[model samples]
Each structure stands twice: as structure tokens, then as C-alpha cells.
Target chain A: MTPACVIDRAKLRVNAERLKTLCSQRGIQLRPHVKTLKSVQAAQLYAPPGSAITVSTLAEARYFAAAGYRDILYAVGVTPNKLPAINNLLGAGVALTVIVDSEAGAEHLIAFAQQFSSPLRVAIEIDVDDHRAGIRAQDPELIAVARKIDLQPGLQFYGVMAHAGASYGCFDISSRSAMAVQEARQTAEAARLLGEQGIPCELVSVGSTPTALVDIERPGITELRAGVYATFDCVMAGLGVCNYNDIAMSVLTSVIGHQVDKGWVLIDAGWMALSRDQGTGSHALDCGYGLVCDAKGRLLEGWYVAQTNQEHGIIAHRDGISPPSELFKYGTTLRILPVHACATGAQFEQYHVTDDNDCVSTVWPRVNGW
Target chain B: MTPACVIDRAKLRVNAERLKTLCSQRGIQLRPHVKTLKSVQAAQLYAPPGSAITVSTLAEARYFAAAGYRDILYAVGVTPNKLPAINNLLGAGVALTVIVDSEAGAEHLIAFAQQFSSPLRVAIEIDVDDHRAGIRAQDPELIAVARKIDLQPGLQFYGVMAHAGASYGCFDISSRSAMAVQEARQTAEAARLLGEQGIPCELVSVGSTPTALVDIERPGITELRAGVYATFDCVMAGLGVCNYNDIAMSVLTSVIGHQVDKGWVLIDAGWMALSRDQGTGSHALDCGYGLVCDAKGRLLEGWYVAQTNQEHGIIAHRDGISPPSELFKYGTTLRILPVHACATGAQFEQYHVTDDNDCVSTVWPRVNGW
Candidate 1:
């Protein structure tokens, strides 16, 4: 499989197991976000039987639901147009959970739900870090949104959800821990605030790959939702969240030619394969496009895919030395550990799973697009 | 369609017709590379009946073949692993052309061809403008590789192909023209050299949207392969190759939320939809990830998607002033013209084609991955 995405099954299993163990120890339910891989095989490993799964797109929710993921959470803020699809999934016996941060969004859901005979499971998103979406946890509108959902005839107020995507920017352990604690507190406080208003907020969720992997305590957080941890990447490595060996996904490419004078080794895996995600740009060490590794998943010292075109990646030495032509002969296969697993994995249609012996064992199809 | 890829069918027709007329005037065949759109509908418009098409991956070649594209060229350097797929296409009576830049690549093709009863049409990739792949036009190995293919049975030396990818970096018309001239001359010279060696070189292909659009003369170039011209992008607009109006492709997204204080209006279209290709980064004007446009394809002045997450694009004014919250309210549909047409188009599985009235006329499915 040339120019393919290779997933180290062992590393993926280890990552998933570690997360499961951590969540179990903290007595928090693990609702693994299936949006990262969007593979039923990987989803099964991360989200076992009776476990809920988080999805960013309705397409993913539909795909996973077809694959027997009953409890589906469309994590992204719900829009008016997506109501029909969410309603269809719910009609098909899927316990679909939708999120709303604004009253307008809640109103849209309420209006849409009135057309349906059954209740639509809804969650109020708390803006714990002000990263992307969600209403500020301290905002009075949070209680209003929850009350709106609770009072609605055909909408069930599930609880609250928070993702401190801001924690990804924390490069230090202490900062990540602090962000994790803050995430937990803010989300729990929102739930507490809702409970004070006579609303039964059973679920209080908050998570991010970095925060979920580091935080030692979660006082009131009942559930965690993380995705990238299952397939660690250069950004996670740069943040000291996981070692390079923990990264399961890689782009398998072949050396086509070289620019010996420019010290560039041209590989078939370009931005189209490795993805144009410069996730490690803000870190102490920027790994260009991705870290170059041999076919056997062993890292090639001092080498990186420094530049890329649509279909050509230029591998260069980090120390500014020319790579030997004989060492990187034409047609030799190489693997590239991507900068961001989610972005990189989304580029490919499927993953070529490899075993401990570095032999491709199976091919897993991935769901892409919205 | 919310957070979808929208292709302006009228603009695409204009772009395709312009390229077809230009190639006709220049006395060259226009074999538009389908790697950009990867849609049979778009290919039908670009290549038309009896016209050849170029592809970067065998998956594309197979897809086009299935869609009744008889003549196809796998433009990327062929490796041994791809032989079976090429042979499968060839066996299905598709006139597939494979490219090779190295002697090792040629030998692999030769070895693969030996197993087949019929000959494989091969093209020597010439390195014009010192771009990504292909052998240097002046290199002696160019002749050696061509001779090797010509000498081998079950392998036919088709001609030469050159892509002036470096011309993308040429921001000025004069520099672009110079690069175009050099691209045509180098590729033509390589074909001439092969012809002088008593080998018939039927084709001399030179390409890249910039070169094909700007070049005034092509002495010996027989065919031109350009893809992105069918769907102009921000990078092409920044290079002055095409106007913003000529950009047929735009990601149709809706405002999901906002950070009013930070002057950020969040859209549903993120890197997953717009792509992470920062093609305009080196230009005088970097249009962040993409240029912001209203739902009707009208440009929103001084506003662009400055930053993006997996499924969220943060739109902001180029200046520091915050956008009025009323103008970009949640659920307001917005269109984003991407930086690189190829990279952005590859992110989607289909294109929602619209007419001048901004009414979606038809949905065209796109093929992805190798």
C-alpha cells in the first residue's frame, strides 16, 4: 500500500487502554470521540459495548450508529439544518445527544422538536476556556438555555459538556494540570448552577486529550470525551503528553527521486498525504510537516519532511546536511509521523493497520467529510 | 447543504472553455488533470469526449476509466507496487500513460511490463524549473531512461511531461512568463533529444495553471496538462493568474457562533472543509486560510478565516476592528474561497454545483484517496 495511512494497532490499543484505565480510576465514564479515526474497528477498541461516543459531524454519528453505536453525541453545536438528520438518527432508535450553547440554537432545537412526537436529547455546552463554542459557564444565559431545554415538550435536557481545547496550547505539565482543574471546576459549577435552578443535571462532562491524560483528580466531572489521545501525534509529543513511540498513525510513502544539491529527498507523501497541519509550530521544536521514520516505524535521526507540494514532500536533514542518495534510494518506503493526527488522518480514506512485527495486518475504512 | 463544497458550474464552464480555446490557439491538446476536481461531471466538462486526461493517482485513473475516460495519464512517478493497478486499467482497454523520472523507476516499469503481453505507454518526466519530481532536462540520464524504456519490450516511450510547480511561487507576470518559457523550452528540448536518438517522442507535455495560462508561445509542446485553472483559488488570485471571480470553488458554511470581544465570528467550515493548505503564505497578501465570501459568492471586504480548528473556522477582519454581530449572526450562510483549489477540493467527497442564481443545480460526487 503505497502512499497509505498506517496505524500501529499496538500503540493504539495501548493508548486506548491507558485512557480507559485513567477514566476507570477516576470513576468517570469514557465517551471516546469517534471523530478522530471515524473507524468502526478503532471505535470498538476505544468505545466498548454500552459506552457512548462523541462525534463532530452528523455523518459520523450516522456511520457509527449504523455500526451499533447507540448512544451518540453530536459534540459540535447543533444548527437548525442538522435537526432533521439528528431526528432521523433518534427515530432509528439511536440515543442521539445534541449540544446547544446559545438560546437561538436552543430555540431552533425546541421548534424542530415540536414537530416530532418523541423528545430530543439535548446538552448545554459550557464555555470553560472560551476556546471555540459554548456559552460562558458564569453567564446567566447558561441556566436560561438549560431551562429552555427542560421546559420544552419534545426536548430532554441531558446535562452539560465542556472541552478545554485551550489545554492543547499548554506546553508544560503544571499549566496542563491547571487547565484540567479549571475545566473540571467550570463545567461542574455550571451543572451545580443548573441544579440550583431545580434542573436535574445528571451528566457533567469536561475533557481534552492533554487534560484527560494528565489531571490526577476530577471532583465533579462524571464523563470525559477525548479523541487525539488514541492516535498520538507530534503536537502531543511536543507537549510531553506522549512520547513519539505512542503515535500510532503514519503516512506510508515511497522515495521517488531526490534533489541531491539542495539536500532534499523527494517522497511521494506530500501535503496531500501528510496534511498541511503545522501543529508543532508553536512548540520548542517544530517538526516541519512530520517526523521522517523508516518503513519499520523507526525514527530517522535528524530528518523531517521540511517542505511539501501537492504530491511531493521534500525530506531534509534537520542539521542542514545533505541526505546520502544511496541511503534513500528510489522506491524505498518510508513512514511519516504526522504533526496532528486528526487533521492527517482525515486526509486518507482508510488506515492500514500494522501489528507488533510491523507487518500490515488489516485495512480499516474511515469515514470522511461532513 | 450546510458546510459543503460548492462549485460554480458557470465559472467552471468559463474556465474550462478559456483553457480549451487557449490550447486550441496554441496548437496543443488540453489534457486537463482531473486531480483537482476528481469528479466525473467536472472531468466531462474539462476533458470532454475524445480528450485525454492526466491523473496524479491510479485511483483517479481507475475512477475516470470507469466513467468512460479512455485515455488517461497517471502523471506521478510510477513505482513497482502501482504496476498491477496500471495493468488492470490497461487490460480494461484504457490507454493509460505512466511517468518515470529515474532509471530505477524505469527499470521497475520495464520489469512489470515484461510480465504483460502488451506494451505500457510511458512518459519521461522532465524536471523543468527544478520543480518537485522528474529528471533534469539537461541530465544525460534523461536519455538513458528514455532509451531504457524504448529498448524494453512491452514498454512504449510515449514522450515527456513537465509540470512547472515552481511557477506557483512566481508572483509577478514577468517571472511567471519567464518560468513558462523555460518550462516549455526544457520539456520540448528533452523531447527533441529523445527524437534525435532515433526514438519517436509523440508527446511533449508542459503544464501548471500559471504556465499554461500565461505562456505566449510553445514551440514544440504538444499537450498541456493543467488542473487548478478549472477552479481558480486564492493562491492563483494572489499570483495574478486569475481573478477572484474566476475561483469557481468555495466552501459553503454557516456561522455557528462568535467571540464578539475578540472580533471573531466562528463558521462551521474548518480545516476539515477548507483544507490546511496555506498556499498564499509567501505572497504579498496572505489570505489567511481562505478569503471570506457571502453565501451569494460576493466577497466580504477585509474579512477572512484567520484561524481554523478541526470543524470551526474563526473569521475575523483583516484590521483589528470587530465585525458587527448582527451581520454575521448564527446560521448566516458564508462561502470561503480556498487558497489552493487542489488541496481544498480533496477534502470533500462531493461538490454541490450552483448556477448564477446561487441555486444548487446538481450534486457531483468526487473520488478521493489512493
Candidate 2:
């Protein structure tokens, strides 16, 4: 395969170990979100011994459950239609926990859970920084929703979880650290409030890659849930969350043609292969599509994918330093450091994994779509 | 399933019929590109009996070929490594025609073909308006490359093809029509020049969704190729190429949570489900990620997806027409019309195809990745 998702196993191992060490030292359980990997092999490596894992889709939950993952967290807000699938997983002895931020969502799930003999575990989603989903941490509904879970039949209020998605917006270390503190504090405060209301909120979870890696303080937080740290990318590098050398995933591509006069070299890795994610666009240094590198994963000086179509990527120089035609001749193999590893990795069906010396070690299949 | 790719079969059939009628009236062969649909079911409905269909990836060629499609055109510029896959299809009695624009590309294919018994068919890609790939129509290499293909052993010059990609930049019909004219004239001119050099050029193809739909005049074109028209999108609607009512594909999602103060309804269809393709960003009527619609596919006036995360989409009123909280309460099902059909379609593994009556008749699987 010319244009394929390539994973560096060595770098991935390093990242996984780094996260494990950080979480272990912080006295918090590391529930690596499987949404970023979606690979059974990767999940097993990231969360070995069947530790609690997080997922963004029901498909991922089923896949991970089938692969011997016992403790699973469906990180997204649970809707009514997905209850059957969740029930099936829970019935199959999988400890599947769902999150919701509204009374209607909890009531809907509660009504569906009534038919099941086993109680369905639930978590209250709290808003940390207004990034996306969840009820405001200080909102009175936070207690009301938890009470609904407690009062409902065949439902168990597990704890509270909050994803500080706004941490991604912070490119500076201090800002990201501050967002982490706020995430932990807000989620912990919500749990504390629920506890004061006679609701036993046992598990308090808060995470995002930036916060999970940068923050050393965790007051009441029990578990840290983060994804995309195992396979870092240009966005994380721009955020100063990880070194560029720590990026394990890249798009392996080959040059097809070029416009010599315009100093444009066309490659097979387009948006369909790389994904149309400009996550680093808001950063001080915006990688057009991604940073370009040689086949050995060495940076090609200042080369980058300037533009992309459905099936073609135009690689150009950032500093107008167009190299000789010999450097980018047709059929030359190249590697692209993706802006967002999660987005780019989702574009492929499998990853062509390589070892430290760039030797093909294995090909892992990726489960995509819900 | 929430956050699922849904196809309006009635509108899809209408769009297919419209294209077939237009091509039939113009005396040109309709080679609908399968890059958009990537579904064998949709391909049969669009180009039944495999009448020279176009593909952006070798994966699509193999998929369609397995489903009895013989006349397949690998439209993107071919690289050396992909020749094996192309040759595999050709060896299986599939007439897999590839496009090439550079001398190196042609030579590489010629060398690869020498290892095989059968000659490889190729089309010389001519640059229509410097949109992306291809040699300029008037460039001296146009004839030189044609003669090289003629002189090279194990290589057959099929004809010339040009994709007026720049036609997408035209938001008006007149400019798009003019681009179509130039596309046809330039590609036809390249074919004529090849003929003058004792090289026989049979096929002269020129197309783009905007150009194919807007251009009725093609003096030297033998076939028209287009992809996105069969599943129109918000970008097409913004370009005045098709009405919003004609779009056949959407993301079926449900309101999970909300930010009442900001008037934002959080949905499950994020960029992961509906791709991060902001193609309509440059258009006059730019939809943030996609246009909001009801479950029945009726347009929600002035509503759009404001932002997206991995698995979360924030739906808000584009014109600040915040309706009552009851209208977008949690668990309410809604649909999102994508900005680019091809980009969004690539996100799903299958499409939940429904008819005009909102009845899900069948589930069509899509061939993703290369």
C-alpha cells in the first residue's frame, strides 16, 4: 500500500509507558480512551490487565468487550436508541458505564434500564470549560440529574466524568496546566456537591490529553481518561504537550507527479488518506495539512503538504526552498506527520506498524464507524 | 443508529436520472465517478453495466470489479507502487485504464507492464486550468509525452483526460460554463495534437460536477465524468449547482445535551461522523460544518452545526433564531446535510438508505480506504 497509516511501535510503547508512569505517580487510575486507537492490540498495550477503558461509540464498546475488555466507559452522552446495544454488552458481563448531562437523557436510559435484570451503571457529565457536552458544574441540574439516576429503577449512579476539551485550545504549558486544574476542580466539585446531597459519587474522572500529561495535581479525581497521547501528532507538538519525536503515527505515501515550475510535488496521501483536519490552524505555527518527512521519518527540512484534494496532496516548501527535481522524483516514498493523529488514523482500515529501525513488524486492523 | 450516514434514496434516484438524461441529450458517455458513492448498489443505479466509471482509489476499482464492473478508470495520477494492484485488476480481465501526466510516470508504468504479458492502457492527463495535476494542454511536453507513450513498449495511449477542478471555484453558472468550455477545448486540443503526431487518441474526457452539470457544449469531448452530483451537498447548493432539496445524503443524529445560554444543542454527529470538510467556507452561504435538518430531511431554517469535536457536534441557529428549549430538547432526532458529499460519505462504513416516505429500504455498504 502506497498511502497507508504507519504506526511506530517503539514510539507508541514509549508514549504508553510515559502515560502509565505519570498516572501511577499521581495516584490515579489511567483509563486510556480507546476512541483514538480503536485497535484491540493497541488497547491491550495501552490498558493491559483489563483496566477501565473509555470509548466514544457503541461499536467501539462492543469491539473492546468482545476482545476481553471488561471495564468500559461509553464517554459520549447516551441516547435512547443505543440502550439496546449497551444492555447487550452489560448482559454479556461487560461493566459498561454510560454518561449523561440532562434529566431527559437519564430518564430515557432509566426507562430502558427498567427492563434489564441487571442495573445499568451511569455517570453524570459535567461541563468544565464550556468546550462541548455536559451540564454546567455549578448548575443545580447537576444534583437533580444525579438524583434522577439514584431514584430511577435498574440504574446505578457510578460517578461523574468531565472532558476538558478546551484544553486543546491552549498551546502554552501554563494555560494547559491551568485548564487541567480547572477540569479536576470542577469535576471534583460536582462530585462533592452530589456527595453532599446524599448521592455517593464514587468515581470522579477528568481528562484530555493536554491535562492528563501536564497536570500533576489531582485532589478528588479518581481516574484520568485521555486518548491520542499514545500516538501524538503535530497538534500535540504545537500545544507543547509532546515532542515531535514522540509522534508515532504518520501517513506513508509515495510521490506521483509534480509541477516543476510551481515547485509542487503531488503525493497519493490526500484528505481521504490524511483527513481534512486543520487542528493546528489556530496555533502560532500552522502545518498546512501536515509536516512532510522522508521515508525514514526524518523531517524533509521545511517541506509540508500545502493543499489536498480527495486523492492528491500537494507537497510544497514552507520557506520557498524548492529542492532539485531529483529530491522529489516520481515514485519516491515519503512520510507525513499528521496534524491530528486521531483524525488521520481513522481514515485507514489498518495500520502498517513498524519497529524502531523501521522494519515492518505487524499490521493491526482498526475498527471504524459506529 | 444515531450518528449514522443516511441516504435519501428518492432524491438519489432523481439525481441519477437527471445526470443520465443530461448526458444522453449531450451525446456523451456518462462515466459517473464512484469516488463519491463508493457503493456498488449506488454504482449500479448510477452507471449500470459498468460503462467506463471513474475511481479515485484502487480499492474502489477492486470492489466495483468484484461486483462485475469491467470498464474501470483509475482517475488519479498513478504512482509506481500502485501498478501491482492495477495490474492485478487488469489481469482479472478488467479494463482498468489509468491516467498519467509526467514522462517518469509513463516510463514507470511501461517498465512495470513489460513484466506482464498484457499492455497497460493509459490516458494523458492535460491541465485544464492549473487546478491540480496534469501537463498543461499547450505545453510542449503534451506532444512529447504523447509520443513517449506511443513509442514505449507495453503501453497503449487510450486518449486525453482533464478534470476542471478549478470549476469548483466558480460559484456562478456562467463562469462554470466557461470553465467547462475551456476544459473541453483544451483536452480536445491535446488529443488533436496527439493525432497530428501519428498517435491515435480515441477518448477525450473532461468533467467536474460543476462543469458537467453546467456545460452542454462539448465539441471534442467523447465522455463526461462527474462524481458529487449523484449525491449533492451544501457546497453544491451554495454554488447554485443543485438545490438543497436535491441532496441525497445526511448524517442521522440526535440531540444529546445543550448549552441553553448559548442556544447550542449538542449532537452526536461530529467531524468523526460528518467529516471535517468545510468546503462551503469560501461560499456566500457557508454552513459551519453542515446544514441542520429535521429527521424527515426538511431544512431547519437558519440552523447549522457551529462546531465539532471527535464525537460531538454543537448545533446552533446561524441567524441567532434561538427557538424554545422544547424544540431541541435532549434525545430529539435530527439530520445534518453535509458540506461535501464525498468527504462526509467517506466517514461511514455503510449508508442507511431511506425512501421519500422515510422508510429504510436497505443498508448500502461503502468501500473505504485505498
TM for every model, in the order presented, reads: 0.97, 0.99
Residue B178 in model 1: lDDT: 95
Chain B TM-scores per candidate, in order, are: 0.98, 0.98
Interface RMSD score of each model: 1.3, 0.8
Docking verdict class for candidate 1: medium
What's every prediction's RMSD, in angstroms? 1.5, 1.1
**After superposition, which runs of candidate 1 have C-alpha atoms over 4 Å from their true positions?**
none
Fnat for each predicted structure, in order: 0.50, 0.78
Candidate 1 clashes between residue pairs 3 or more apart in a chain or in different chains: none
Q: Score the docking of each candidate (DockQ).
A: 0.65, 0.85
